[model samples]
Target: MQAAQTQRKFRGKNKAPKWKKPDDGHVSVMVLPLAITDPADLARIKRLFGSMWSIKRAVQRDARAKVDAYWTAFHEREEHGAKVVRQRLGLNREALERCAYKHLDASGHLKHHVSKALAMHMAAEVWNGVQWHLFADATGKRHGRPKTGRWHDFTRIPGRARSHTTDRKWETFRLVGTLHGHKMAYTDGGQYTVQQPRRMRVPAAPSGPVLTGKTLASGKTGTRKATWWDHTGPLAVVFAGGPDSGRGDLVLPVRIPQQPGQWARVEHFLSNPGRWHKVDLVRRRKASAPGGWVYEAHLMILGPGYTAPAVRERREQAAALDRIGGVDGNVSNVSVASFPASLDPADGAPASTEITLSPEERALLEREAKKRRGRARALERSRRATNTAQYGPSKKQARRAEQRAAKGLKPKAVTVPGGARAARVDGVPKQAFRRDQLSVNYREQRARQAEHAASMAEHHRFRARQVAREIIAAHGPVLVVEDCDIRTWYRLWGKRLSQTTPGLLIAALDRECQAAGGRLVRASTWSTALSQHCLCGERVKKTLRDREHKCIECGLAGKRDLVSATLAAFVRFTDVDDPKAAYLDTTSSRHAQIVFAQGLEEALRESTAPSQTTVRGAGHAAVPRQRRETSAPRTAGRRPRATLDEPRPVRDHAGKPGQRPGCDPQLTLW
Candidate 1:
C-alpha cells in the first residue's frame, strides 16, 4: 500500500506511458567562432603557421616512408624489400618532404623545365640556389634563365606542412622567385607581416570604430549576445607596435659574486644576460574608444628612502642578470597586460591564487581581441594584395589561377554509422588541468617500473629459498627459522653465509633430528601451562608460586613451567606428541617401529631424577581421568594408544569450572 501510494505520487495525475518517455525540454546549441585581429601580430601567428605549413611535401613524402617504417618496425618484418626501404630511405623525413613538394608543384603548376633542375639538386650534390643557377645542362651550357620554377620558401601560406603558402599569398611578394627570407616581409615589433589572401574572412561586428558598411540584419537583435569566455585560460595579451616602432634591443644585467676576494662579474652581466624580464606594461584608461585609454607602462626599481641609486641599481641589475636567456622571453602570460588596477605589481610575496573574469567581462575582452585581430589582418591584406585587377590574364596564367582557386575547395567527408558520437551540446564541462607531475608514457612506463620491482622481489625470494635449502642439506631434512620471516633471514646474510644464527641453527638441528630415529618439528608456537583452574567438584590443579605441575594423580609434581617446555623439546625430536601421544614413537626411517608406555609419574621421574625433592604448599593438583589421555604401545607396523590411571575431576581454588587434558593411553588426538 505504501509503494502504491509512492507510485501514485510519482505519477501525479498522469500515469507513465508504456513507451517510457521523458520530455525534459531540449537546450539550444551555440557554436563559438574564433577570430584574430591586430594585423601586425598576424606575422607572429603566420610564422607559427608557416613553420607548421612548410612540411607539406616533406611530410607527404616522409609520411608514406614513416607509415611503412612504422609497420616494419611494429611487426618486426625482415623481408628484403621492407628491410632495404626501412634501413636505407624510410627514415629520411626531410628529403622525402622536399621531393614530394617539388613533385606536387611541378604537377600542379606544369613547370616542366624546373622539375629537372630540382631533381638534380635533390640528388645530394653540393649546390646552393646560385650554384644551381650557374650549373650547365646536358648541352654543357648554362641554363641561363635559371629557375623557370621557384623554390619553396617553407615560411609561407596555404602550403602543405604546418606552414605552406599558396600562390595567391606567395605571388604578392616582389621577389616571388627569390630565395631571400625578406622579399615581401615587413616587421612590427618582434613579429613579421606578409601578404595574405584578401578574401580571408572579414569581421562581422568589430570593436572600436565600425569600418565596413555591412549592417546588422533587421531581424538580428541589438547585438548577438557575445559567447561567454572561460577566463580559465591565460589572458590573451599582446605588446603593441606599429610601422613607426623603433628596432632596438633592451639589455638587462645581472651580477654573480666570485669566490674569496675576487671581483664579481657584475660588469660582464650588464653586457651579457643570464635571463630576461619584461620592463613594460599596458596602461589602463576609461576613454580611448575601443582601445579605451591604454599605453605602455615603463618600469623601474626604486630603492628605500630613494637613496643609493648605484647600490639599488646594482642589486636590481644583479637579480635581473641572474635570470636572462634560455627562456622564450614572453611575459604576456604574466598579469602585466592589465595595468594600474592590473598593475597589481609584483608584491614580492609568494605566488597567489588564480584570478577570474566574470562571464560578461570575459566576453567583452574576447570581443575586443577579435576586433583588433580583424583590423590587423585587413591592413596586411591591403598592403600585400597583387593581381587584384589583372584585367587580362595570359592563357597559361588563367589556367594557373583556376588551379589555385580549385586548391581551396573543401574535401568531402565520410561518416560511418555509430562510429563515434560528438560531444553533448549541453553538459557540465570537463575539469580544467594544471601541470600534474606524471610520466608521459604512463602505461608503458609504469609497467616497466612494476616489472623491475617484481624482478627484485623474485631475486630476493630465490636467495632466501637457496639459503633455506643449504641449511636443510647440511643439518637435516627439516629446517626451522626461529624468529624472523624467511625472506628477510636470507636476504641480509645471503652474501656472507652464516650457520650459527637462530634461523640457520634451527634448520641444521632439524636435519640431525631427522637423521636419528626421529623427525624434527618446530616448537616455535608451543605454550606452557601458567595457572591452574578447577574441573568439576572441589578438586583444583593448583599452581603454587614459582612451582610447575602439582598434579595429585600420581602423587607426582614438579615445576609446571618446565613441563610444557620439556614436552616441546620432546616433540621437537618426535613427529607428534600431546596428551594422547605420551607414549608415541617416531623414527626417521620407516623400519624403526618402536613404542614405550610410562605413567606420568614414572616419565617425570625418568625425565628428572630419583631423589629430587618435590616442592611443598602447592595443593594436590588432580587432572581428570577423562581428560587424561594415555598413548598405547605399537605392534610391529601398527601404533596403539597407551592407557593410564582413571581421570578424576578437579576444581580450581576459586571453584571455577574447567577441564584439563591428561595422559590417555588412547593415542588419537595429537
Candidate 2:
C-alpha cells in the first residue's frame, strides 16, 4: 500500500522527482584535538613514543653501519669475481635482517607492526644510499677510481644531514584495526568513533526565507536564504576516550572541533552509519595544546555530492582579440607593457616595478644574525670561565700535592677562580637549563625572521599577480611572458634575486588567465635578439652596451627592449623565422632558451604584416646586400670560389676517378 501511494503521487507530469542525483565529491582531512582526562594515560603515551623513537634511532644506526661495511668491502675487492665478492661481504637482505632484527625483537613493549614499519623505513634509506653509490660509480666515476674531492661528490656536500632523529617528536602510525560503519576497533584494544562533518553551501543566507527581486520596487527588499547541508570527507579524527568510562578497554570517541550546528550534522551522520575506509594515527606535538595521541578515520558516507569546476580548453576565440600585454621579467624587476597594434610605436614603453623590503623586515633579519653572533661570543666566554674555575691550580702546587701523597702528608687547599658549582664535577647543574633556554630563544628568533621573509615574498607575488590581471583585463586577454631561470639569477645576482621571481609571477598569471577564459603565451628568451632589427630578412647584431637599435637598412630607431617586445609579439602571432638562427652561439649552454607555448599558425595568416622569405643560397646572411656593395648594380650578384680545402666532388666507388667517393658526379651541392 505504501509503494502504491508513492507511485500514484508521481503519476502525473506535474509530479516532483523522488530524489536528485548528486555529483562526485573530493576528500580532505580535518584536524581536531584529543581529550586526555587522565594524567597516567598521558604518561604512558609519552613513554610509548620515547621507546619508539629509541628503536627508530637504533634501526638507522644499524642500517648506516651495514651500508658503510658493505661499501668498504666492495671498494677493497672491486676486481674480484661476483660470486667471491658476494661470499666475502654478506650484503643480502637475509644478512641485514640477521644483524638488525635482534635489536628490534629485544624491545618487549614495541608492537610487532610498529617494528616492521620502522624497519621498512630504515631499509628504504639504506637502499637510497646504495642507489646513490651506484649512480656515482656510473657517472661520477671517470678513468678508473671515482673522483675523491670533486665539488659534486656526496661527501663534499655542505650542511649537516640528520638521520632518524629530528626536532619534531611525532611519528606516523599505520592503523591495524577493523572498521565497521561509524565504529572501529583494533586487536590491541584501540577504538574510535567516526562521522561526517557539515559545511554551508553557496546562495545561502544566515537564517531567512528566499526573496524575489520584485519586492525592491516597493522598498521592502530582503536577501535570499542560505542553505546548510552535511559535508562528507574521507578523514575522521579519533580522540582519546573521555574519563569515567570502562577501564579495561582502550577506545577513543570522535571529538571534532567545530561549530554547534556542525556537531548536530555529525550526530545525524553517526546515527545513519557509513562504509569504512581507513584510519591514521597522529600524535599532537604542540607545546601549548593539551597533549594526546589522536587517530584519523577515513570513511565514505552517502550524502550531498560535489562536482569540480571545469577547466577551459586552449582555443582562439573572439575573446582573444583584445590588446596584447608583454611582460619582461628581469633579475631585479619586471617590466610590463600593454598596448594595441594600432598604437603609435613611439609611444610604446614598458613600465618597470620592483619590491623593496620594509624597514621592519630588514630589522628582523639583522636581529637574527646579531643573536647568533652574540650566542657564539657568550659560549666562548663561558668556556674560558669554566676552565678557570675548574683547573686554575699552578704546576708547583700540583707537584707538591703529588709529593705529599707519596710522603703521606696532608695537601694544601687549592683555590678556584669562580666557584666549584661553575664547573661540571658530578653531573649537569640547574644552571645548565639557562643555556638550553638560550638555545631555544635563538631558534624562535630565527624562525620569526624566516616567517617575515616568506610573508614579504608572498605579498610581492600577490601584488605582481594582481597587476598582471588588471593589465590583461584592461588591454587584452593574451599574455606574453619570457621564460626565466630564477636559479641562474640567484647565482649571478645573489640577494637581488628576491626582487624578481619570474616563475611565481608567471604561474599566478596562468591561473588568472585560465579563470578569465584567456591564454598565457610564453615566448622564447632568444626573442631578446629581437632587439636587433630585421631588414630584408637579415638580422643586425649589436653589443649589450647599445641601448638603442638604429637599423641603417630600414631606418628604424627605438629603445632595445621595446623593439624586442614588438618583435616578440610579431614572432608569436606570425611565421616570421628568427633571424638569429644563423648566429646562435652554442658554446655556453647557460643562455639556451627553454621551449614553451607557441602562437597558433592560423593567427599568422590573419595578421596584416608581410611574412619574411628565406634566401637559402645568399652569402653573408647577417649583412644586407645593399650595404655590402654600393657601386655594383643590383642585378650583378657574385659567388665566392670554393677553396681546395673544401670537400672534393663525390667519386663513384666503381673505379671512376672523376667521381667523388660519397655523392653522384651529376649532383650539385647547394
Candidate 3:
C-alpha cells in the first residue's frame, strides 16, 4: 500500500529522484570504534555476523549462477556477450532481486539463517555486484566479472534506518544512551548501571509531525512529512531470536575520544543540521587485539554542512585567489609551476617546485618492501613444505630425472622457482594441487605481510596528501594538469610508479583544489601536447630518453618535466566539460617565455650536484668547474698527476668522462 502511494505521488514527475553526490560539501562519515569487551557479547556479535555472511554468500552465489546461465543460453543462441545477454533477458537490478527471492528465500534457504529483512538486504547488495559485471557504464567501461568472495571480504554488515509505527522504515539497529541493566547482570544477580558520557547524548524523540519543505514544478512550496531518527550514542544491533533464547540483541558503546580536538570535530558534526541515514558495522583484523579483530561503526550523516574554518580562510586568502598552477606528474616525481592569474608578462617570474620522495623516505619504503618480500617467500616455502605431494617436480624435470635413471647416471640437482631444488621432489607435479595443511608460521607470515602492506599504503597516502597541501599552499587552488592516463605509465615503469605513486599525488591535488573552492582543469594531452611544445609555441618532438627539452626553434632549454609544466600553465579548454577541446593560449604562451627562462636560470643556480638532481638530465646545461687561483705560482707542476683522492669526472653510461653521449660538449653559459 505504501509503495502504491509512492508510485502515485511520482506518477506525473518527468524524472526520477537521484542521489546527491557525497563530496559536494554536505555528506560526511564519522568512524567510531565499538567497545565490545565482554566475552559473551563478543561471541554473540560474531555469531550474528556469521549468520549475515552466510546469507550474503548464498544470495551472491545464486545471483552469479543465474547470470552465468542466462549468458550461456544467450551465447548458444546468438553469440551475445554478457552485457547484451543482460539486456536481452531484461536482467535489471529488480529482476535480479526477484530471481534471488524466488530461488533462495522462497525455497527456505535464506530464512533458515537470517530474517526476511536481512535476507532482502543481502540480496540487494549482491545485485549491485552482479550489475557491475553485466553492464557497461556511461564511459563504456565494464568491470571484470565478480569473483567468489572469501570470508574476510564479507566484513561489513549494513544496518537500516530507525523504525516508526506509522512509517515503513525498518529498524535493524538503534542508538540508545545505555543498554538494559539486565543484560549486564552478573551470575550473583547484581546489576550495574552503564552511564554514557555527556558528549555521547542521544537525541530526543520527535514530538510532532516532521515536514521537509520543497519547491514543486508549479513554483509553489510543498512539505513532505517523514520520520527522521538520530543515530548517535551506543549502537544496538538487533537480531531475531534463534534456537538460543537466552541470547538477545548485541549492544556496543561508541568510543569517542576524550581529546579536545577530536571531541570538538565530533561535536561540530553531530550538532550541525543533518540527518543520520544509516550505519555500517565493520570488522577488521588486528594482530594486537584480544580476539585478533576490531569493530568500527561508520555512521553516514547526510547534509552535515560542516567545513573547517582554517580551510575556508585559506581558500579566501590573497595568494590562493591570485595564482594559478600547473602540474606535470611523472613516474618518480611531480613538477609544479604557478603563474599569476592575470597572465601578464610583466608579472614576476613564476614560482616552480619539484616534489619527490626524500632519501630517508625512499630507504624506509625499500626496507618495508624487502621485509614483505621475505615474508612472501617464507609463506611460499611453508606451503610447499607442508604439502609436498602437491608441489612435486614439473613435467620437464620428471622427464629429465627418468632419462638420467635410464642412462644409469646420478640425478643432478637443479634450482627451480622459489629457490627449491628439483631433485627434492619424489614425483611428478599434480595437475590440480590443493594446499589444505598450512602451518602456523605460514598464517603468521601472511598476517605480517598484510599489516605491512596496509601501513605502506597509509604512508604513501600521507606523503601524497602532504605534497598536495604544500603545493596548494605555495601556489593556489586553481590548477591545470594534462589528462594523461597514468595506467599507461604503469606498463612502462611499473616498479618506479609503484614506489612513487604519481597517480595518487594527482588525485590528492585534485581533491585539495576542489576543497579550496577552486578546480583542477584537465587539459587534453592529445590536443595540447604540453611536453612536445615549448613556451615559445614551437612543436618539437622528443623521445622518452630525451629528458631535456632543448628546442632548436627558440633556443629554449630546461628539464623536460619542468618545461612541460610551464607550457601547461598556458593551456586553456574551450569547453570545460570536453577536455579534448583544450588548446594552448598563444597570448599567454608568448608572454610566459620570459618567466620560464628566468625560472630555469634560478633553478640551475640553486641546484645541487648534477648526479643528485633531477633537473639536470642528460645533455642539460652543467655548472662550470670553478678554478681556484693559486697564490704560490710555481707549485702547479702538472697538477700533481691527479691523486686518487681527487674525485673522478662525471661520466656517461658509455664510460666517456665529462661529456654527453652522441653530442658535442657546448659551453654556451659557462
Which candidate gets the maximum TM-score versus the true structure? 3
Off by over 4 Å in 1: 1-58, 61-65, 73-85, 101-105, 110-670
Order of candidate numbers by lDDT, starting with the best: 3, 2, 1
- Counted clashes in each candidate structure: 64, 8, 0
Tell me the tens digit of each residue's lDDT in model 3 across 31-54.
767776678767766776787776
For 259-300, candidate 1 gives per-residue lDDT tens digits of 332222222211211111112222222231222222222221
What is the TM-score of each predicted model, taking all chains together? 0.16, 0.41, 0.70
What lDDT, from 0 to 1, does candidate 2 have?
A: 0.39
- CA lDDT, every prediction? 0.27, 0.39, 0.60
> What would the C-alpha RMSD of candidate 1 be, to one decimal place?
39.5
The per-prediction CA RMSD against the true structure, in angstroms, equals 39.5, 24.4, 13.0
Better of 1 and 3 by lDDT: 3
Give the worst 10-residue stretch by lDDT in candidate 2.
Answer: 589-598
